[model samples]
Target: MWKFILRRIVVMIPQLFILSVLIFVLAKAMPGDALTGQLENNPKMDMQTLMEIKEKLGLNDPLYVQYTRWINHLLHGDLGLSYIHQQPVIDILAERIGNTVMLAVCILVLTYLIAIPLGVISGRWNHSWADKLIVGYSYTSFATPLFIFAVMMLFLFGFTLGWFPTGGSVDIQLEQGTAAYYINKMHHLILPSLSGALIGTVGLIQYLRSEIIETKMKDFVKTARAKGVPESRIYSRHILRSSFIPIAAFLGYEITGLIGGSIFLESIFSFPGIGQLFLQSIMQRDYSVVTVLVMISGVATLVGTLLSDIILSIVDPRIRIE
Candidate 1:
């Protein structure tokens, strides 16, 4: 098991290396550097001053030189400075990443809770009304863009019925550190979380549904049914357990999708998370922040993938034994 884990960890190294290189290269390929429009609209600044600032920031340097410096700083645990925020990229994100993670976690839990049961029931009773209804809902979710859903949810929940707050991670009007405050925070999460969960549920539901259908046809399940095992037991103990392999394998990808999708929802809801920061950074041409943010997301994906592998291995002893 240790050896398997070690091998997986080693594999991540090259993957991250390639991702970092690609992220840096693509970031540099953007239309202009952070200093492009710095003086264009500023009447007080002159061309020479702008040029000097560019020199200081190594904007005038060759691509190889800039990449070397950036990669070195990255290796040394420095994520570089954000031109827009006027702070270290890490520092700016430190204040905001937690909100994004919290939101992601909420959506993830909700997605699984709702998706798994629906998938199981639909797959268990293939061609039934419940299955058709779930399939239709899944198709609709796939068809609708996340941002549009977020806007609709915001308008309905935040305005029409006035059920939930539309924006912000928490309500400042409430006393901090109190039960009401935390509860209010969760309340603020409901609209966005629900929208994200609905969209995120599609893939999991389809995947698990297929797995369940396939598991039902397996020899063990056939034997269980042949012996007149209890229906609930055969469904849960036999079918569900066998179907978990696919769902378990999907864990890492599920999270990566959530964080990536958060960018759209965060903007629509005006949530102060990394997704919002990432958009702002790109508009401002703050490639430093963009590069770092992409790398962070890449890291999350790589680590999550590793976790999923470890989980599957632990759960199915055959993987470790092999």
Candidate 2:
């Protein structure tokens, strides 16, 4: 396992290099950069001033040179300055990432807690009323667009019912570190978290249900039943374990979603997280922030993939990492 992990980490070096290049090229390919957007409306900004600004930003440099400088700074732990925010990219990300991580963690926990058991029960009871009900629910949840769901939730829970705060991480006026402050924070979190979790849960329930049902039909499960094993034990000991492998893989991709997938949801909820930051950065053509965000997301994806491999190996002895 250690060797496999090390090998994967080693492999990721080149992958990340390629990924960084792609991110840089893509950011550069965008029609304009931060300076252009910032100065676009200012008719008083002359060509010479724009040229000087480009030089200051190294935008006048060849693409290769710019990429080299960017990557060099990146390697030295300097994520560069955010053109829009006038702050270090790292500092901006640090402020926002915590909120996103909190949101992601909540969504993940809620998804697995609700999806897994429900999937198992639905599979076990296949075609019964319980299964039918769950199937209907899954389809309904799956078919609902996240933005629409978020809007509906905000209206019902936040606007009309007045059960939860509609937006923001916390009430701006609330004193930090107090119990009421934390309570308000959690209250604000509920709708967005539920929005993310409900979307994720639908897919998880469908996948796990299929896996469990298939695993139940496998020869080993048949043998266990033929050997007079109790139904509960067969399910708990054999079926679930066998069926969980695919779910583990799905979890890896979901890990990336924790950060990346929250963009639309966050925008809808007015959540102060990296997703919102990402959206703003794109609109402003903030290359530094955008590139750093892409790198962070790429790293997260690689880590998640590695974690999934380790988890799969642990759960299924048959899945030995080479």
Against the true structure, whose lDDT is highest?
2
Model 2 agreement with the true structure over 1-322: per-residue lDDT tens digits:
8999999999999999999999999998989888887788688987789889888877889999999999999989999998788999989989888899989999999889999988988998899999999999999997888888889988998899998887899999999999999998888888899888888898889988998888899999999999999999999899987788888877788888778679987898999899999999998888889888888999999999988888888877888887
Worst 10 residues of 2 by lDDT: 252-261
* Per-residue lDDT of 313 in model 1: 78
Off-target runs (Cα >4 Å) in candidate 2 are none
- Which candidate tops TM-score? 2
**Could you tell me how far off, in angstroms, the CA of residue 163 lies in candidate 2 after the best superposition?**
1.1
Over all chains combined, what TM-score does candidate 1 have?
Answer: 0.94
- Residue 255 of model 2 has an lDDT of 88
Q: Tell me how candidate 2 scores on lDDT.
A: 0.89
- Expressed as tens digits, the lDDT of each residue in 1-322 for candidate 1 is 7887788788889998899889988987778767766776578888899899989988789988988899899899999987767899889989999889999999999999999999988899989999999999999999998888889999988999999887898977899899999998898888899999998899889988999888889998889889999989998787898788768877877788877988998898889999998888888888889888889899988888877877787766667633
For all the candidates, what are their Cα RMSDs to the real structure?
Answer: 1.7, 1.5
